[model samples]
Target: MDAPFSMYGPDFPFAYDHWLKHPEGLGRIPVNRHGAKVAIIGAGIAGLVCGYELMRMGLRPVFYESGQLGGRLRSASFEGAEHMIAELGGMRFPTSSRSFYHYLDLMNLKTAPFPNPLTPAAGSTVIELEGERFYAKTLSDLPPIFQEVAQAYDSALEEGAHFSSLQAAIQRRDPNAIKAIWNPLVKAWDERTFYDFITTSKAFRHLSFRHREIFGQVGFGTGGWDSDFSNTMLEILRVNVTACDTDQHLVIGGVEQLPKRLWSHEPEDLSYWPNGTSLQKLNQGAPRPGAAKLFRDPEGLYVTDRRGHTDRFDAIVCTCQSWLLTTAIDTQESLFSQPLWMALDRTRYMQSAKTFVMVDRPFWKDRHPETGEDLMSMTLTDRLTRGTYLFDHGPDQPGVMCLSYSWMSDALKVLPLDAEKRTELALSALSKIYPDVDIKSHIRSNPITVSWENDPNFLGAFKGALPGHYRYNHRMYGHFMQQTLSPDHKGVFLAGDDISWTPAWAEGAVQTALNAVWGVMNHFGGQSSLANPGPGDVYPVWGPIDLDELS
Candidate 1:
């Protein structure tokens, strides 16, 4: 029998070329061969990867950052305790992410197995429905009782496949099998809930509850919190680093070390300026401490520290978040008119909060019943204002238990609490999950909350596509370094997670940077000429164009 809950039916077409041939297929812009100078914005993983790629492709890049690098991969110290490294924004990766693995291997980093304790108790899953608790020893024990429900789900999936095939068949004017399958699948795909869809469809009624459980379990593993795919990717990134040709090396110290090391380069050709300084008063403005700006021209790119001083560079590469670019430039109205800008604006970012609590010892080890297994109990709360996940990150120090609580958008709305309130609420929620555990005496809660909505420089947590948004504007990937205005404007190119195939993740950011590097190579390799180049490209260098365009 076929594996349960497989969305891919035998009839489902697995053609990748369909995306390439679609009307919106990579909308690649012609390159400007004479363009040489380039600027990279953002210093996250995406920016770093792009810079590395550009440098390898025979281009000198001066990277800029409005804040510390590794944008969200930040760590913090509590009460003089050892600095605790936690991903403040993006966390984890999947093994199935091929590109990410390739980049990691290229970087030559090492990996460690993620800390998931092997125990028999880990296999159980709990589900809550209609104020009642349900437990399953294995996926086969799930409680979906209606026979027709399974058939409906299967039929819906089959119909979805039929629709795709039908559309293809219609082009040939073949109407024989169209009406029987196409309409039903379309209606099913529009379903609001899995339960509703499964119960209403045919060919799915005979599915056993065990089959549903297996499907649900696998789906959870693939897409849920402990997703194996994402976890594998993270392992690759954690261990891989690119070999340095010079004395310089790129290894994992702490994520913050990346920006600090880059800043230490102190490139002579580049000048730095403070955020509020004017170009005219480059030498006269008082330096602003801890804040710096970088400007590039023919003489070189300059990075000015808070106190307005300048360092110059022959070229610049920006690997920062795109949202920072939205704020740093003076001509917001004009820049916002670009198709890329509109695409960026339309991207939705989910609001999330993570709370790390350090408690005295593992209380659950002793409080459980004789039959209870050593497992992290995950509770799904009915309360609208509660946190979603509560899991252990293991004990780092004696009597210290690390617990993480994550709140998604819905939780953010109902609780409506600030950082401090959120911490209290999270603690309260944790109490509910472990009722007998003594939370008050040992709880050392240091909550970190990021409101992507409030950050002017980071507008939101990377980028997420809204409904129908991904289908139309998918081709924006190949236009990163396309010439705009004139030939001189060619030096400035966009680089960020928003430009990749998948937005809002580290993988997307890295891929976009790679695409940007290719764009730069194509533009400067002499395929197209523009009337004006940006300020950074006043002095032009000519190069031959042979790189493949990604359209």
Candidate 2:
């Protein structure tokens, strides 16, 4: 039988998990180059991962942050509450995300099953659409119409995308088998949108348009997918084939703790660094200020901070959002070729907004007096709130409530609202669905809200590749392979979820950061272990397929 599903490359099918777990460790830099400085722009998860691995390889990684240390992984605690927190960004992680788990396990963090739409973790689910409400303990509890909608999408995936066989290939870790199916699909679907695939598929075409609408509103694993209808079908396919939307778990306490712990974590085995040395020790107590400019001085690559403090490095890895390069930093144009610049400039980001309120307790689980059904459940709605999730912190302890978690248009709708107004808007929409439940009376703390797009440091939540934008993704994802690049562009690399095939997943950030680590090591004349070749060592052989430019 094939091995359990892993986030292996349907695109660049390298086993980053195996490479990281190898006994030989991730190659090495020259002894003379052990203390060479490398600038890591942005202290987000991606930046932290890159810095941690580079430090293990005996390189000193200097971090620069524009905002807080966690970046989008901000987990702000409620006033007066010590343990409860609002996870404002990337929360759900799949079991398939082995590379991310590699570090998460190393940090000794724990995770509980995320309360996705119909998972056991949720206990119960409430789907509200078109002002109608339906509660289900499982998918079988839903009406036949909902069942039909789900079946049609399943049939569509099998008929249109060869879903099962492709997934089996990924599970088996057969790069050749995956590419044979995926490369052809890339050519066939690169210019097609997700909506196009849904409308034109024989299975979906046979079903009513209402089925399609219901499918979008109550999407598989998560909530609504309607916001991503305009994205490339490849993006959606990648998420499905990788199980990125299935069997997800959330980091206990807060996801921020992973990056925070990694910042101070000292690897059991490392090169050159003294015992008990940590990333915290290398950079003194805190990171330098935000990088305001990226330009090359005659001597070396230079990073100028917002306060005009400057540092030179042998190489740099930028983990900030792509938009920041153009809007916030004065990066010399020559550092990137015209096509690459265009690719970065043209990359699209989907807006996402979230609102959270700490409640006195997990009141949502209380059953109605007359009915046996749950008083409230993990909610998915077409209303302004879009999706609502409840966090249970034992039976009596206070719980956190995510009032709204929305993306794209739904997110933009409340982009201008304050936390109080956003909370009011969410409660108003939810009232129509759960008029009997008084969510307002149970509130215990000030609401927390975030519109990532409104933050200059991150122009938007994450990337959303449009139809025909495959080339742009190709350019950005492959930028870390600097062997063929001009000397000017060789030293600088990009690593983030946005620079990955599967954006919005922490695994993407982890994998891309590994690629950047490989890039930095190779820049200093380092090499990978023969037994455990890095992504760069085998990238040329197993890299993503390239489509014709004319097409």
Candidate 2 per-residue lDDT, tens place, 94-180, comes to: 999999999899999999999998889999999988888999989999999888878888888898889999998998899989998
Candidate 2 collision pairs: 9-13
Quote the positional error of residue 142 for candidate 2 in Å: 0.8
Q: For residue 62, what is the lDDT in candidate 2?
A: 97
Which residue runs does candidate 2 get wrong by more than 4 Å?
Answer: 549-551
Which whole-number lDDT from 0 to 100 does residue 239 have in model 2? 94
True-structure RMSD, every candidate: 12.4, 1.1
Top-lDDT structure, candidate number: 2
Instruction: Give the poorly placed runs of model 1, Cα more than 4 Å off.
Output: 1-37, 77-84, 106-131, 135-138, 145-219, 222-324, 332-337, 365-367, 384-408, 414-416, 481-489, 526-551
